[model samples]
Target: MVAMTAAVGARPARAAPSAARLRAWGRGAVGAVILVAIILQAGAAPFVRGLAAVSVPSVVAALLLTAAATAAAAWRWRILAGRLGLALTWPQAVSAYYRSQFLNTVLPGGVVGDVHRAVSHGRSVSQVAQASRAVVAERTAGQVVQIGLAVMVLVALGMSAYAPAVGIVLLAVVVACAGVVVAAAVSTRARDVVHRELDAVRTAFGTVGTVAKVVVASLVVVAGHVATFVVACLAVGVDAPPQRLAAVALIAVLAASIPFNIGGWGPREGAAAWAFTSAGLGAATGLAASTAFGVLAMIAVAPGAAVAAASAFHRRRATRAAAVEESS
Candidate 1:
């Protein structure tokens, strides 16, 4: 009996790590499948061709747009953090956001950078939960606003004219979101978290001035992203109308937000292919455009590399100083 109890007690310690490994494996598998599907459907030609089309001008535009978007995103984070009673400055938010974006672009699973950002920020504040919530709230706001803008664009362009399926997809998404809300309401733990987060969101963005600022910032970020996509499309000789391209760009952006991706690949390419094809353009054009956009996006986040390097250097210096003090 004593042996059995000891074995049972030890099981949890081993099980936790095993479960985490399984989850990581599952995510990797999903990402691989997504990449395989894109290659199978679109082939590797478009990616290679798009790379050759990248120009110095396009690279410059991407860098500029990325800076604007990052600044807007950081501002939004600052607003939310302040509302949550966390100490955050614009400069800190901007630097952290850049580092996070760089990490997101280079790391697998697409969200590792966000996870790091939340944990690091939380640790600094000594209110880990609140800090994490702030990140969540900021990202959630951006997504909601992005979706809203997409819907408005689709509606304005008349969904039936460009793509009837988009309207159906939007409806399905709304229903799914409603279902999730209902499910959360029925579950005790989920309901508590939902209510708590909702309260936090309200507190952070409740005021008229704050809400306006957040919405405007979100719009700017979305516009910058869409513009970059447009630039990428132009670079690849995609001659679609600006309005049509904007709509498709929004769809691709929304798709890129899917977490089942390898370093921000997968769904983005898949969605771009689908969106462009549905808009009466060839799938290859979509793939090429998306590929260019991906490259440009990476270029835009290059500043993050410097930020990361500086951070590492500072840490090393601090460690060395601490060692010297200890020895003395």
Candidate 2:
């Protein structure tokens, strides 16, 4: 009677939805909202004119720069993964990085990409959490470098008028981020909080030499990404000085960190529009530049979809083969 009652009362656990599936739903929702907003904005003539002004050479340059930025990013991540004591070869790291990029684009949560990369590189959940720590370290260092560059450019170009506000905000953000990293480093309890579920960050401080290499490489990658955004601005004929472009890049990149907006579509474009418009540029030009960057990103990430497909297929085939062998 006890066994029967227990069996009747206990419900079987339902399988949870995959991170990839959740990401797909999120991307679809974001795309739908953006489409609806575009329809409502419906100022057709200006949008058409702005898009038409996207020059061919400028587009080409934007594409090339984006590719370079992507490559640099892959290199940066590979270096970081090595520091975390992952045994990824150079090619493996680059491939995994690009694959993660595709996941990040289509998946709702940005960390979904990191999760996939962590598993692919053979990290245990705890190890993956440690690895995530390394990734955060790399990102924090890059943000600091970016803010410093923006401030320096603003000072050099006599754009000190906008400095106090933007500079203070940037500094505050950097300090907050630094505080978080420092706290994590000192807090074993915090490390345990994100344990198996975020384990890539656990082994985060194992090798100081490797960690330093990752920090430097990450800086170069982030700088390259910012430069590409600046080039995109030039492509759209924005005459703003370099400082302004840097500021715009910082705003756009920061916006992309938000989880809700499919690669930060609405927020990114809105930020660009506001930034450029404040500098006395037309919204149309800002939109064009932002749109160009978006399109380039879509194209650049297309290959990632193929990589993901292949990876899935290979994994499935391996599973089937193992099952067949076991049966035999």
Candidate 3:
């Protein structure tokens, strides 16, 4: 019986990597499809135009805005981590956040960097699960704030113009989320995990002051992103009113959050094109703005490259030291 159990466990252990590989391949395929669709619909002219429009000043502004956003995000993470007993300092969180942003911008799955940050932090504290939950909470809080702001902008700009389509999309999302909740509630083990995560969330965000601070920080991050998008539009000579740009920009921001993207390329451009066209702006203009935004965003996260390089060098040094100690 002991041998049989051991064999059974070994089968899953061998299969795990294969399963992970399959999932990664699937995500890549989806991203490729989305990118292809965008190219076919929008053509490649806007991308070139966006690149041409980039200037030193615009890039500098993007970098500064990105830094501010990253700082705000790191601050929020620090608070959540502290509540979860993870002991992350502000500087550490900012560095990790920068590295994660760079990884997400360049990696196949836009979330790889975030996953790395969570796992690395968790390992350090030996509270892998809690650490992971902190990331989830931080990200979830940001998304909630973004969505709320988007809704407000949409409503203020008269939702009737975009209501039918946006409402349908939102309805589908709500239904899908409800289904997941029901499924989790029905599964005993899943329910336990959900309860634990919820408890962590409550502990981290339960206090009014903490909740307020998180919301404010998230708002700052969102505002920085929106400002960057506006800058991108201006660089590309969109020449639209701030309100109109803000509305379309918010929509594009929401679309970018969708997971199907080739290094954050596909859905964002498509959504931008759609949003701009719906708002009576040229689709090409939307594409140009989206392209510029993408470039500027990549530039803004350039610091992450330094952080990642330093991290790799440190790890190599540690490994060499460990090898020497082992030999001795």
Candidate 4:
């Protein structure tokens, strides 16, 4: 009876990991399919062309823009964390953001870095749940604002002359996301968790100043991304109208926000190809631009690698010190 009970208890634990792996595999497969489809549609030469187009000056410019955006994102994260009673200094937040970006860029699913950030920060502050809530609220707000900005740009740029299919798809996605939120809110099992998340959200939006600050920070982050995309476009020799390029870039950015990506590939390149083709910029141009952007992004997060290494070194040193103290 004891052995049977132990086996039964372990069954749920094993099942949970199996289901998690399946979901992760499904996400990776979706990203792979999208990437493969883009390759089939546009051929592989554009990717090669895109990588060869990056210049020293363009990389420098992208690095600066990425830094600015990362700073603003970190500020926004700090605000959310602060509202939730988690003290996060700007420097600390920026370091963490860089680490998070590096992980997101190199890891599958594009969000493992964020999970690490939340859990790490939570442990640091001894409030894992609130830290998680802060990260979730900050990321959710950023995505919603980003999607809204993308739609506005497409419409404002007179996209009636071209297809706005990407914008429509984003809108549908937003609706679907809203439905998921509602379902979670109404879930009996997740009631307490949902309520706690709501409390974080409520605190974040409790003041007009807080709301305005978040919007400004989010806008800066969005603008930096859009500008970096334009730089990528120029590097790839696509001299389209700045206004139209901004719209297309925003759409690509929206697609990059998709969590199904392999590291940071797949959906972004596919969407850029689609949107650029829709706008008569040629699928090749779009793919090349996105490829350059991806390279620049990885370069931009190089500091994160340094941060991770330094952090590990410090941790080891501290552990050694503690062990020595105990021995003495």
Which parts of model 4 have CA positions greater than 4 angstroms off? 1-26, 161-187, 319-328
Candidate 4 lDDT trough over 10 residues, lowest sum: 1-10
Error of 4 at 241 (Å): 1.0
| Residue pairs of candidate 4 with colliding backbone atoms | none
Assess candidate 2 and give its lDDT.
0.58
Tell me how far the alpha carbon of residue 285 in candidate 2 is from the true structure, in angstroms, after superposition: 1.5
Pairwise lDDT winner, candidates 2 and 3 = 3
Q: What lDDT tens digits, residue by residue, belong to model 4 across residues 76-103?
A: 9999899889999988899999998997
Ranking by TM-score: 3, 4, 1, 2
Better of 1 and 4 by TM-score: 4
TM-score of each: 0.86, 0.71, 0.91, 0.87
Using TM-score as the measure, name the better of candidate 1 and candidate 3. Answer: 3
The candidate 1 region of ten consecutive residues with least summed lDDT is: 1-10
Q: In candidate 3, what residue range of length 10 has the lowest lDDT sum? A: 1-10
**Which candidate would rank higher by TM-score, 1 or 2?**
1
Shift of residue 70 alpha carbon in model 1, Å: 0.6
The C-alpha lDDT values of all candidates are 0.77, 0.58, 0.79, 0.79
Q: Write the per-residue lDDT of candidate 3 for residues 102-200, one digit (tens) a residue.
A: 977886546656666776687678766677778878887887788788888789877456555456457756886696589688998667756765688
